[model samples]
Target: MSEQPVVPDVAAPAGRGPLLEVVGLAAYVRLGLFGIIGQHTWDAPDLASSQRMLAIGLRVGEQQGRLLAIGASHGVEPVELMRPFAGVLDSFEARTPESSWWEGLLKGVVGHGVASDLCRLLARGLPGDLAAQVVGAMEYTDDDERATSIVRAGVEADGRLGSRLALWGRRVVGESLSLSQALLTTRPSFGELARAAMPATVAPEGPSADVVAWVLGELTAEHTRRMDRMGLAA
Candidate 1:
């Protein structure tokens, strides 16, 4: 009889991914704005925005690298975990199309916030050191402040823009939820991670339906709070 080749379990307990791609995306966006600034001398605002964006990109990129390192240390390939949700980021970028400077800024807010929230949720179930690394990768201290300033400026400049952006923000929430569900469906590993992340209140014998509802409810509530923080109607 021929000996069988041993196959390692891909879904075994291990580390996870990060918000790296999002920051990389933001970097490209900033560079685009920088080019626009170069084209127009009246592009000081964009220049300033570009500089800030570059800083965020650099910092977040470092954290992202750290996350990958930590994930590798734990024998987990973060890319495998992230592959299923690739569409989510693309969908978000598509849904929140940037037609103006203010809109671009709003996209930055929504993108960063959503990625951070997802990373935080995933980090909940991970081992201490790994979880800390995952969480740390998403720490954007100035996101809320910067978002607030941009939203306020856009609103003050044109009240109608605020209303439009409010609607856009709501759409962002819905799309994010949709993407999340889609990801879970496509990725069994992610579903397992989410299950492991559940609180103690969810009994071992509890129905998975209940667990799903609880997680969705928590995510929805958090989404509403985030919207409110951005001065939009939840």
Candidate 2:
């Protein structure tokens, strides 16, 4: 029989148990994305596409439920956790408004992808059970592919649309990175957790010492891959 590969001891590296605030933050992100996607579904260019996006929104709703469940151990309800950051995501969307159907679709793809990545990476310092759950809650490969398909097909149809979306993709990446950094920096209890999530090569200094830059680099690299998969420029 083949031997199983060893899983590293994430407990020590995780530093401490799950930060309840981080769990709330993750729930708020998905909850907000679900609401925004529902609106986007209604505003889709056609009924057929709207129906498809609505289905995707349903899946996002389910993921939001999972994220909330992760907070169950803390005895916090979904709303309680999400209430603190009431207008956070709305602000993000406002900063990068969509001017067209394709832009709107890319908003869902780029925004949700980057935000979820940030949440999962930051949640890595949590305990084994909660950390695993947080990681699972953020896993949305199928949803990304489905949403990316919508944008990918549209961009493939119009070369000009591809050009426009490529620009939009870059804009969203920058805005998304800025928001993520702001969230980690401004949130009262997240400093240690963010430090724990840093790359192993970097020493655990304060938030200023190469932390934000490394995270931005990691997220930007992932965003570039997603854009490449859709045949769009990063």
Candidate 3:
């Protein structure tokens, strides 16, 4: 019988930001759990893919958290805050198929969730025009279509039998929005960002209502597409 090769523990170097620290911690936990399971199982290929997925998921989560932290600290719009990270994410398209699958799932879940949360937050906290504009910015694109494809592929590869996994993609977005709002309410920095991003204006009236409605319509359509990609309807 052949001896199974041990996977090395990858460490994050010192002075890495808090976001990376969080990612590292989560990655380690995932690695350890999956490693233990792999040791007891015969499915080596599945185990390998699972590890890749967990690693990439950790990286994406860390990056998103870091972006949010920066945005909150600088009091910038979330879109402006995420622009640089989006560039970084764009570069990962060339990663290995396993890595790409993992990364895409993580990005899609986080992206959808954060956008949803930002929209809901702004709706309650900011002037109607600015809030609507910010919400409108969450619309997915052709690029997002590719990401969802990866997620679908990953799920298929896992050989896990259930529709619940498909539903997870949509659930993450809803949960993320709710969780982010709770986080924002407690985090003074997020409040500062909201204030900075918001323009001084009263409630919407007349034409402003139409503009807000248009923005909401666009956001709703985009979210619907995302849900469809996740194999969820309504």
Per-residue alpha-carbon lDDT of model 1 for 70-179, expressed as tens digits? 54565645554333333345555677665666556555555455545654665665667656656665565674565456566657787788788887767666776666
Candidate 3, overall lDDT?
0.40
Best by TM-score: 2
**Runs of candidate 1 exceeding 4 Å displacement:** 1-45, 72-88, 202-205
| Candidate-wise lDDT, in order | 0.54, 0.76, 0.40
Count of clashes, each model: 0, 0, 0
TM-score of each: 0.68, 0.86, 0.35
List the lowest-lDDT window of 10 residues for candidate 2: 7-16
**Tens-digit lDDT string for candidate 2 (1-234):** 245333321211132233666766678777767776787887787898899888888888888888788667667777656656666776688899888877877877888788888877878866677678788877778888888888888888889999989999989888898888887677634556667777677876645546777777778888998998788999
Please identify model 3 stretches exceeding 4 Å from their true place.
1-147, 154-163, 198-225
Compare candidates 1 and 2 on TM-score and give the better one. Answer: 2
Order the candidate numbers by lDDT, best to worst.
Answer: 2, 1, 3
lDDT for predicted candidate 2 compared with the true structure: 0.76
lDDT of 2 at 66: 80
Candidate 1 shows a clash count of 0
Compare the candidates by lDDT and give the number of the best one: 2
- Model 3, position 27, has a per-residue lDDT of 28
RMSD of each: 8.2, 10.2, 13.6
